[model samples]
Target: MIRGIRGATTADRDDEKEILLSTESLLKEMILHNNISAENVASVFISATHDITSVFPAKALRGFEEWKYVPVMCMQELDVPHGLSRCIRVMIHYNTSTHQSDIKHIYMKNAVSLRPDLKK
Candidate 1:
């Protein structure tokens, strides 16, 4: 079976280092909470708000030793009115037997407001 684990976080600023670090932190939390391994990840899709243009959030995944070969893509989030700013979101497609309701969706930093219901 296949499932998608979703996560989102906000960077302190638009700096490259901040973006990279923030993304890495969010991914780490997602992986830890879901007990996910790069080997089981089919793909990852990341998106950043228009205000965040310092670097591609997907670049953070390469920092994980086992995630270097994982397929990943990056894109800009739709600039919807009143949308969250400096936000990075990720959706990881994984090969797992876990039921949908059992999957953990992570929301951190200011992005917590984006999905208050999913906040742990």
Candidate 2:
């Protein structure tokens, strides 16, 4: 089976360190909570709001020695009125036996408020 895991985080600025930290934390939590291994991940797509351009969030994962082999891509999110700012979002496509409903999606820090329905 194939399932998707979602993760998001917020940063105060579009700095490299901030983007890397938030993206790393978000990906780590998503994988840990869902008990997914790097080999199980088919691909990862990351996006940042228009306001963020310091660095590509995907690079953080690519630079990680453990996840260097995982396929990752980054893009700029569509700009819309009242859209979330300084946000980095990730979608992981995993080749797992788990059902879609069993997958855990993480929205951390201020980003958690963006999806109150999943806070529990």
Candidate 3:
């Protein structure tokens, strides 16, 4: 079955390094907690707040050699009023046997407020 794992995190600033590092960290944590492999991943969709225009968050995936085959895309998050800033969100679609309810969605940094109930 194809499952979508959600994760979000905030960068310290709109710097390229900050965006790339934070994205990598969040992706690592999500994969670690869920025991997911790049091979099973179908694709990844990343969206960043308007304030973050330094670079594309999907660029971070290039650091992972095994993820070379993983199709990834990047876009700007909707500019909702009072929405989180400097935030990057990711949705990873992959083949998995795990039930949707059991998937561990990761929220870090200022994004913890986005889903207080999932905070841990």
Over 15-70, each residue of candidate 2 has an lDDT whose tens digit, in order, gives: 99998989988988998899988888888999999999888989778766767788
Sliding window of 10 residues with minimal summed lDDT for model 2: 59-68
- Kindly list the per-residue Cα lDDT of model 1 for residues 15-57, writing each as its tens digit: 9999999999999999999999889999999999999877888
- Quote model 2's TM-score: 0.94
Candidate 3 colliding pairs, count: 0
| Clash total of candidate 2 | 0
Q: What is the descending lDDT order? A: 3, 1, 2
Q: lDDT of model 2 at residue 46?
A: 97
Off by over 4 Å in 2: none
Give candidate 2's root-mean-square deviation (CA, Å).
1.1
Each prediction's total of clashing residue pairs, residues at least 3 apart in sequence or on different chains, is 0, 0, 0
What are the per-residue Cα lDDT tens digits for candidate 3 across 1-120?
999999999999999999999999999999999998999999999999999999999999889999999999999999999999999999999899999889999999999999988765
Q: lDDT of model 3 at residue 81? A: 97
Q: Report the number of the highest-lDDT candidate.
A: 3
Q: What's the TM-score of each model vs. the native? A: 0.97, 0.94, 0.97
